[model samples]
Target: MTDLISENLQNKTGLVIDGAMATELEKRGVDTNNDLWSATALIENPEAITAVHKSYFQAGADIAITNTYQANISEFMKMGMTKKEGQDLIIKAVKLANKARVDYFRLLHKEDRDVRAAHPLIAGSVGPYGAYLADGSEYRGDYQLSEKEYFDFHRSRMQLLDKAGVDLFAFETQPNFDETKALAHMLKLDFPDQHAWMSFSIKDPETLCDGTPLQQAIKYFNIFDQISAIGVNCTTLENIEPAIKNIRAVTKKPIVVYPNNGDIYNPETKTWKANRQAETFTDLTPKWLDAGAQLIGGAVEQHPKTYNK
Candidate 1:
């Protein structure tokens, strides 16, 4: 396998990842507040999932991170869905993104008559175990699970997404070393042909949510060849530059950074505080790129309109 995504990311600079899928879904009137989060729309409103993907393509996204963030089998089964149904939904998430890419390409070719309009890639999203807990441990990263437990939780989803044929894996919003290490090892040992970009949610510029230094974590993660890019996501705007600098100093891999919309996430309240306008986020893009982020965009509070800016 050629690993087309790694090739594309290596060849392209300033690659624009799509903004928040859940935020866009909420904007379109989908309630994303339950344990299932955005993944609920997979069963209740799948068309809405495809619609968000289309909006991001229209907004100039170079990659569509699939809406499988909260679509794990165990959780779906708890919601009265069968194991097969959950797997089918995960596969559907990838298919919807691929359909949007095909549809967008048709429009682009008809309008511009150019093949150079950055062919979009679909990245299958694998959110951390905390996202399943829905207790905000994704930002805290202090889970008490063993590596085997972590693997058992994530492997089914990763396997299903792989079978669905996404262009790459996005092991994103991880906040601890154990989960990251376990997932990285799983990918290396089980799916060596595929590549993934692992991003973390940090407590600050230097520390991950688990109190591990970003550089120290990167040093361990960078040793894995299956991890194509290493960086951060769902972090604050102010911490991005310093965080990227720390990662950049240690690894030669492509760096990806997608911070929140210049707002503070109150884990206790389960809401964003003091959300700023898109312009505040747009202003920070240049600095993040200047700090050496190859793939940059926004998470949660960001919309495609913001991505367009």
Candidate 2:
């Protein structure tokens, strides 16, 4: 397995991941009201995807997650594209991110580039199956699938991402315990040389959205060397610290946390409303690092300005 994440962590306090992709695309005047979300930009406004990735790198992010969070083959087929066309879009997502990385590095002064802690990484975003459902089932984790079904749903995208040359996978916003296990198993059996980080959608500080205890979930992946890091994401700022403590108590592996900008999501309406008591990343990043978060970032409603802090 590659020691990409571990090697980076050994030199820095924490690696900063890029902020939200879909929401950032929305700010650039892209239409994301459809089921495809940010992936729509892959076909219609690919240059915007590259610009977003470069913006994050400029904002000091150490990783740029590709815009494939909702770009699965099944969804593409539903949009009237053939299977080959859909798979091409998935590969295109990684190419766009890599272009941004190369373009960003080329613009940096040689002295500035040489002073970097580690090279910025491209994380192929493997969003949960609920993301394809596009109804916010990711936050509830109520879906069920047999072992073969889960494998069938995720395998093609993983293979495409791997073939496209992602530094690693970012299995972010996962909520179902069984689905996470299936993904971990798939990584071990099918993509033996690839490494990934698994970040969950939590119900509270103590449990996953599917009701598995946070400690139990963290422990389950402790033996999987391929899971480079384990933590939570797409959750509120308030939930991060306690969840990190729970995860750190169970594993010595790196912990990745990217909580949403404190806003309440109405899955039914697919809109966000302000949270009066929401905490800022400036106020919480130090606490999270102290509590054991090794990689930190913002989720939906966050932007380059948020990460620049």
Per-residue lDDT of model 2, residues 46-97, tens digit only: 9999999988887777888989988899999998999999999999999999
**Candidate 1 Cα errors over 4 Å, as ranges:** 110-118, 277-279, 299-309
- Reference-based lDDT, residue 102, model 1: 84
Best by TM-score: 2
Question: Candidate 2's error at 154, in angstroms?
Answer: 0.3
Measured with C-alpha atoms, the lDDT of residue 192 in candidate 2 is 94
Over 4 Å off, model 2: 299-309
lDDT per prediction?
A: 0.82, 0.87
Q: Candidate 1 residues 172-261, lDDT tens each?
A: 999988899999989987888888999998999899899988899999976787787889999877888899899999998889888887
Model 1 scores a TM of 0.92
- Worst lDDT 10-window in candidate 2: 300-309
